[model samples]
Target: MTEGTSNDSTSDHLSNNGRSCCNKESTNSNILDAVQTSIDSLANKEWSNVESRVLVVYTGGTIGMVRNNRGALEPKPRDLERRLRGYPHMHDEDLAKEKYPNSPFLVLPLYKEKHCIIYMIHEYSPLLDSSNMTCDNWATIAKDIRSVYKMFDGFVVLQGTDTLAYTASALSFMLENLGKPVVITGSQIPIFETRSDGRDNFVGSIIMAG
Candidate 1:
């Protein structure tokens, strides 16, 4: 399960995966439904004239996992960006003409037609497994987001499912007076897999974060 927090209805941020095969057609429909629901929900809402930017704090998880020489899933630095870029649904080069070389963030442009979301992915170096998540790690994520609070319109936290609920709770408390969306999501299967839930999860987060 993934949880998100906002001033809107609590049900808006809930996402769960049941036991079933990954049907791409069904997945596409579900993704579109989620996007449509979000757009409809925002019909009466107000937004600024500036382009929407979301800060994605990816703190290591199965979503970014890649197979090693031994064919075992493991966290690999920089692999997430490569994988995401390979997916057409996740990256748009024209919208990301400007790049920050010194930053660890990958800017993504989603939904180019209208109501676009320009998000940045900040993947942690030397990724840590969910089992190693602790108070200190939580604090690090909080501080990182706080450090750039004024830059983005919303935020997303991607982590391993093993400790996703805990981090979500911790972040909810850590960010005081949070006016934007904060979504915490992860996948049970590696994103590189053909039947993985990561694609939808990532796209849905972008819609909410926008």
Candidate 2:
């Protein structure tokens, strides 16, 4: 997930089959109770038996951002790991809290949902912004995915909106097999922005990738 959080959002990020199906406050309580309970009666790692595999390739996005005391944006690599470990779906109280703490409906269950594997590959350029995106940069991104293609079931590409569509189209052309999704997304707002679109976009990207 990319790093960015806005306290102003009330949008429900989780749903099924395109229908809105979650409440901001109790979404987590409901989901964990649902998925975990449904799978509870089955053997361990019910997901392992699923027909498809999920590979979370977190490139860079608002979901990965944290704010410094100075109000500057910073990426917290460790927090990402912790959030995933915590499994926001396990319970609403601990993992359900918004990363920004300003938005109620932006809760993420990345901490709860399990992927076949997760990869963290930040942009190559120190100042890589989607606005200045280039073909070479896109190539590097594609190359990274291709390099890891054989190791996972599917791929997710975290990116900036400035060039999200272009990158996605290019990726579709470059990657073969197409056995799984290679979803790409970024927020209209910065992850550090009080009301940024980072969280929803991130959660959505992860869901789509899966």
TM-score of 1: 0.69
Residue 129 error, candidate 2, Å: 2.1
Tens-place lDDT per residue, model 2, 1-210, is 222232222122111211221122111122223323433443445334443333444445455566789977655553544454344432243422322222122123444344322223333334356667665555555555444444444556666666778876655544533444677777766544558677566656655555
Candidate 1, residues 1-210, lDDT tens digits: the string is: 232344432222221111111222111123233323433433233224335767677789998888899999888886676777667668765544433222223445545566566555676765768877876677666656544555667778889998888887766656545567778889988777889898889888877887
CA lDDT of every candidate: 0.63, 0.46
**Model 1: lowest-lDDT 10 consecutive positions:** 13-22
Best by TM-score: 1
